[model samples]
Target: MRNKSRKIYSMLFLLLFLWGVLWEAESVYAANWGSVELTAEEAVLMDADTGAVLFEKNAEEKGYPASITKVLTALVVLEHTSPDEQVSFSHDAVYNVDRGSSNAQIEAGDVLTVNDCLHALLLKSANEAANALAEHVAGSREAFAEMMNEKAKELGCTGSHFQNPSGLFSEEQYTTAKDMGLIAIAAFHNEEFMKIEKDLRYTLSGLQRLPEGNILYMEHKMMLPESRFYDSRVVAGKTGYTRDSGNTLLTLAKEGDRRLVTVVLKDKSPYHYSDTSAMLNLGFQETEKQSLEDAEGFLEKIRAELVEKGTLTEETKLHFSSKVMLTLPKGETQEGISYLLLEEEAEKKEISAAEAKASDSGMPDAKDSALPHIVFLLDGRKVGEANLYREQNIRVMLSEASPKTKAAFFAVTISGFTIMIAIAVFLFGGGALYGAKNFADERKRRKKWKDRRKKRLEEMKISEEEFRILLEKRKKEKKN
Candidate 1:
């Protein structure tokens, strides 16, 4: 009873120990997504390539965009008007903007090309430039705002509405940080728009204030080389400010192999630049490109666990059908990646008897044995997935041993076979010897019995003939 109880305790202790190891390993791979202090009420950092959100604070909460609305305005105008096409400013386009707001002070009937207007809209944050572009593209500001809302919906912005193209304060003009990030991400993909936005300095010659060309510098501090907030990694940016909207800044920057888009809305002046810079630094520090070495190491560990659990044979292999170049958060190791082995789907086809026989005798498909997948998770939530399979290139190295390993394996196999053969031979030889000896002993016993019978007949003083007659008479007497 004591032995049985002790055995149960041993098994329970072993299970507990294994569970503790797995729990610790999992804990070591998860990230803490630390909070950052910022002046903006809403902010977000996103991967430009994947549009994956890396960080956010109230990103979905709607707030006034101010002049950052011009990003969408530029997008809408670029759709309809070529950069070289002439856009005429109407009386309303120049006069409808609030008196103190930023503008090029254009007069009615002033004509500027769409490219000049884009430069003014994004670089100078000119309200008149936005109105001129909107009216030229859609015939009215209201119509243009409607187009902006429609485009926002198509871009998957859930909490966004546009009341004006200039981003001027209106009860209905509101957009979330996330929505603006998405818009910037999509816009940056346009080569023409990128070309226009990336310029740090441009002179507007066709404007009514400067037919001789007025030098316009970008308000985005990060793009200026002399500004304290300038980041060499910054590729392009847009800045916004209004009495009601505070400060809003959107920036796209690249460092090493990463391209990031950061948005800060409703931050204090100058703090917008600092907040954006902080966000960009955080994005660069917290995100990393998955390395091939890390992937290989992770697969090895998974392979070992699968082998230990008997779900996978020692010779079974694993591989990715496509390259796994995901940008994941810092502290997220391959250990955070989870896998699932999908059930093998059998192929159905008519087979000839010969083909069936061949298939039954040949090696089975590797996928028939195992189907693996890599699940990408962030903050314990699944974000993406990749299928893992055993391609011909991923053949099990264990199955194909090295020269020395193969030599050792063959030697061991031969030694085992020899031992088995020797044991079989010994058993056969011993059995044969025992059978022969038993036969010889049986022959001797039969001869001795005959001799004893003869001796008995002699002792009874009976001759051969008389012995035979006596034996017959004894048989008859016994029968009677």
Candidate 2:
């Protein structure tokens, strides 16, 4: 009984050790930002290209967006109407928002272009502008809200829901930092949307009928240089404030060639630009680390391939041998040499001829002998083939190209052409030779046309009197 008890305790201790190791591993790789100095309830930093999370503080926690909700509102409006289309403000637009909501000073019956309204909505964070844009798009705010929810689903924002054009704080109206990051990414891609978010100041045209008839002007709340940490990297951002979502900010910044999106919600202070700045700094640092790791991984893959090919000894020691200077995208995978064996003997010439046939047949022979045949398979289907040494080179080439190239060369060449032409010519001819032949043929045809045109111009160069006398002499000779 005592021995059994000892075994149980030993097993328990082993499990605890494994658990500790797993915990440490997760802490190293996990996105969770623990105990940050910022007072935000939820925040996130994500890569604009792959939407991979670089850092997070309660990123999944639900919160409000306030005027940032207008990002989606603008998306819906842009989808329904062109920028130059005019939309008149109705009483519904003026009063549909919460009683104390921020206004663009848009009075009922006011006329403004959709583009101007979007500028007010995005740059000014004007609740009235959101309402006017929504009503114009779908004939009412209720229908526009439906469209917003649908778009959110399409964008894979599962943690968000919309109940109003302007975020007026309802239990039903809530979004997480992760969801908001996605919305910001989608909004940033639109040219006009980026323009509004980045603008520091905007001036509205004077109302035609108002007695005061003064131009309305507003400045970005988060653009104050002295407010907190200033980053020229932050090209565009949206600031939102309410009793529920205190001092929220969504910012877009570019560093070198990469773009980053950050979101912070429900901060303790009314102005949380400092928190935003801190988050942006953290994001840039994390992104740099990830980029470095990616470059190292690519170099290591090349080194491994070299080792496999016997070019470098596996145990060879060299400082900085695994250093790479290129940036590879996230989730990038390197190609590795794969081998196959044929069940029956086949000639090398037959194997070469079988390239097209093997692809169509979907079964390839893999042989392990002198001049061994190698077939390329993607997702278990044979794509192409080569001899042993050539195959190894192809594998290395594919690995290097995969980081920078997508859709394969054949797909790209065939995409722009008509289906019949692409299939008959590009697919049959394969790579460079087919392209060269077509180019040369076109040049020859053009040259022929040029020569014909030159000859016609030379014939027409005769004087009008000389041409008439020659024509009369030819006619008299024919009569005789």
| Backbone clashes under 3 angstroms, per model | 0, 3
Stretches of model 1 off by over 4 angstroms after superposition: 1-29, 291-324, 334-377, 380-480
Give the residue spans of candidate 2 off by over 4 A: 1-35, 206-220, 224-229, 289-480
Tens digit per residue, CA lDDT, model 2, 1-480: 999999999999999999999999865642223234677878887767545566678888888887778788888888788878998998888877777777767788888888788878877677878888888888888898999998887665879989898887888888999899988778767777776666566666755455454343333344555544567787777777778778778888778876778888887664466777776676565434232333334334544654675543455322232222221223322243222332122344444445534443423222212232333332232222333222334444344343324335446557656677766776567846777888999999999997986676579996556667989999999999
**How far in Å is the alpha carbon of 277 misplaced in model 2?**
0.7
TM-score result, candidate 2: 0.56
C-alpha TM-score for every candidate: 0.61, 0.56
lDDT of 1 by residue, 1-480 (tens): 999999999999999999999999987755656457999999998877655677889998879998888898888888888888998998899899887999765678889899989998988898989998988988999999999998887666889999899999998999999999989887778787889877878887765666787777788888888989889989887888888888998898889878889899989987888888888888788777674336676677766765686656667676666666555767566555544432322111112222454433433433243444455556653333455554332345335434554556668889999999988886688867887888999999999999998998899888889988888999999999
Using lDDT as the measure, the top candidate is 1
| Candidate 1 pairs with clashing backbones | none
Candidate number with greatest TM-score: 1
- Shift of residue 49 alpha carbon in model 1, Å: 0.8
Q: lDDT (CA) for every model shown?
A: 0.78, 0.66
327 in model 1: Cα distance from truth in Å?
1.8
Question: What's the lDDT for candidate 1?
Answer: 0.78
